[model samples]
Target: MKVLIIKTSSLGDIIHANSIISDLRRNHADAEIHWLVEESFSSLLNLFPIQKTIVSKFRSWKKNLFKKNSYSEFFQLKHLINKENYDFVIDLQGLIRTGIMCRSLNSFGFNKNSIKESFASYFYKNTIGVEKKIHAINRNRLLVAKSMNYEIDQNNISFSYNFKKDQTDPNSIVFISGTSNDQKKWPLEYWIKLAGLFERNNYKIFLPWGSVKEYEECLTIYDQTTNCEILEKMNIDQLAKKIASTRFAIGVDTGLTHLASSLDIPTIGIYTFSNPDLTGVKNTKTPAFNMGSLSNIPLPEEIFIKFNDLA
Candidate 1:
């Protein structure tokens, strides 16, 4: 069977969809699985054990709506998709853009969720209704299970990756402080204190930054710490390799946190404003913890204890 999965953009959501691929591959061992992802995030597909990956610059294409170049690229993507004649197309990122794509292909997707565009459900030839409050990973896996007519073991969730664990320092931990939203950032003062604790135990910290502002913040954190390194700017593949090899990780609500969890690393996700119940790291393969939620900020000491327990 030729299966096409449309899950483009947003690091966390793309990571959550990894479990869907696991379940799909398990149930249909002989099926050819293809993933369609945004051009920027196509690197995430590298570690996955899928057959084919189609990259689209939808985010950028959406901006230049009617330009000749944009239309040409758009049609080229359509032509590339139609050439496959996939037996099943699953739209994990339920959006109007993916919904419209379903018009030219038979697709399946999840039911309406809190933030999902309501009309997106109308396009799916087969829609799997799930609770809005479940973890995003479970919601995604359940949708694939329902569509494929297989049972999902909620307790046995796993994400299959082809990455080999590289050798990293024994006393090293990856500190993820970069987030798309400033509101979700864990306080730099708190991070400095956390680093102090790790330093006292002779542990080294690696901080990877993305934006200019985040790079500056990482520099400040590095300056105040004894054995901390501000990592060189890296792409998704390099970042993934680092996360997979690290001893432990603690990050704010970011896609890298989800990537760490998916890689089976002992990761603690710090939630300053988001709900952990709906978006926390769920890694049965490794010890994962979620601290704080909306209006409930976690203290430095509280996070320290959790980190200690994981270590």
Candidate 2:
């Protein structure tokens, strides 16, 4: 059987979607699976256990509205998707653009009936609604399992990280200092406290910064902790590979934390505006501990306690 999964954008969501592929593969070992995601994230999905990837660069080309090549590229993608004539197409993205794209494809089955966004279901001939309360990883897995009429390993979390042995400071603990929303991050004072705690615990603290704002934060955190060292800008894919080599990791709601979790490293995820139940050390079959909300930040002791489990 041939299956096409349409899940686009957002580094973390794309990674979560990969578990569907993993589950499907286990159920149907001989099936051909294709993944569709945003162009910027195609490289990130390379680590996923899928065979093919279809990239949509619409987000990049939207900056130039007058660029004829942008719309032309969409049409070209439509042509490519139609040529595949996949037996099944699952639109996990559930957006207007993704829905329209799936409408152009030839699929025997389409999971759109119970999509989180109702409007997206209008484009498919076969739509299946899935349980929404489950965490996204399990939600997506169950959706694919429903379409295929198979069961999934509910205990599974989503990650694609491979462990690498590093020589420099095998006891390295990474501090991922980047997030999309300021509301989702812990305060500066909390970072200083956590950094001090890790330093006091005989661990080497490595601070990773993704943007200018995060870089500034990294400096502040590094200065506040004598054992902290800031890592300069690098691609997140490279960062994920490096994270898998770390002994421990700490981070906010940024893609770095998701990336760290993907690496399967025992990570302490600090959430402020978000809920760890939705997205935290995902894909970890092992137990997890998360710190969230503004009222209280996670102390190093609690995070270290989580370490005794996942580490």
Candidate 3:
């Protein structure tokens, strides 16, 4: 069987949708699985067992929609996908733009009531209803299982990755201190306190930043804590490799935290502005802890206790 899974943009959501790949592989062992991902995140697909990785420059194309280059890229993508003649095309990212990508194929997607964008349902030939309140990972799995007519052994779900640790530091902990939203970030003082606690225990803390502002925040944390070190700027692939070698990870509501959990690393996700029930670090293979909630931040000591329990 030939399958094309469409999930583009945003690191965390893509990671959530990626859980279904294992399910697909188990159900259809002979299936040729192709993934359609945003250009920036295409490298992440390399960690998974996908037959083909289709690149979509939607972020760039959206900004240059009126230019000929955008039109040319769009047509090129359309031609390439249509040529594949996939037997099953599933749009896990249920948005208008992704929905439009499925218009020419025999596609499946979330129903109007299940998806935030009800209008996107019109493009899919078949729509499956999944509970929106569940964790994003389960939602994706449920959609695929229901659409493909298979039973999910909820206990056996896997986010298996193609990672081989080069030189794992058993006493190293990664602090994901960067988030796209300011509201989601834990207090800088809290991070420093947590780092100090880990440092006293002889665990080295590594901080990774994406933007200049994030780098500055990391630098501040690094200065405040004697054991904290700011990591060099790295792309998704390089960062994933670095994270795979860590002993543990404690992060805010960011994509790298999810990446760590997906790698089966014991990860604690700090949530201050978002609800953990909808989208939090969760994996059956590893210790995934979701701490804090909207307007209710977790204390540094509380996190340290949880880390001790996991450690």
CA lDDT scores, all candidates in order: 0.86, 0.72, 0.90
Who wins the TM-score comparison? 3
Backbone clash count for every predicted candidate, in the order shown: 0, 6, 0
Compare candidates 2 and 3 on lDDT and give the better one.
3
- Residue 116 in model 1: shift from native, Å? 1.7
Highest lDDT against the true fold, candidate = 3
Query: 1-311, model 3: which lDDT tens digit per residue?
Result: 89999999799998988889889878888989899999999988888888899999889989998999998988889788889999988999998878888887889999999998999999998999998898889989988888788889755657857768668799999999899899999999999999989888899999999999999999999888899889999989899999999999999988999999998889999999988988999988889999999867999999999999997
Measured against the true structure, the TM-scores of the candidates, in listed sequence, are 0.96, 0.88, 0.97
Question: Which tens-of-lDDT digit does each residue in 1-311 have in candidate 2?
Answer: 78888888787787677677667767899888888888877777666666788999868667866889878898899889988888888877877777878784543223445455677767775677676656777777776787778987788554432335355356788877667687877777777877676666678888887678888988888777798888766675676676767877778876777666656566678877776787765655533457765666666567666665667
In terms of lDDT, the poorest run of 10 residues in model 1 is 107-116
How would the candidate models be sorted by lDDT, starting from the highest?
Answer: 3, 1, 2
Model 2 TM-score? 0.88
After aligning candidate 2 to the native by TM-score, how far in Å is the CA of 94 from where it should be? 1.1
Ranked by TM-score, the better of candidates 2 and 3 is: 3
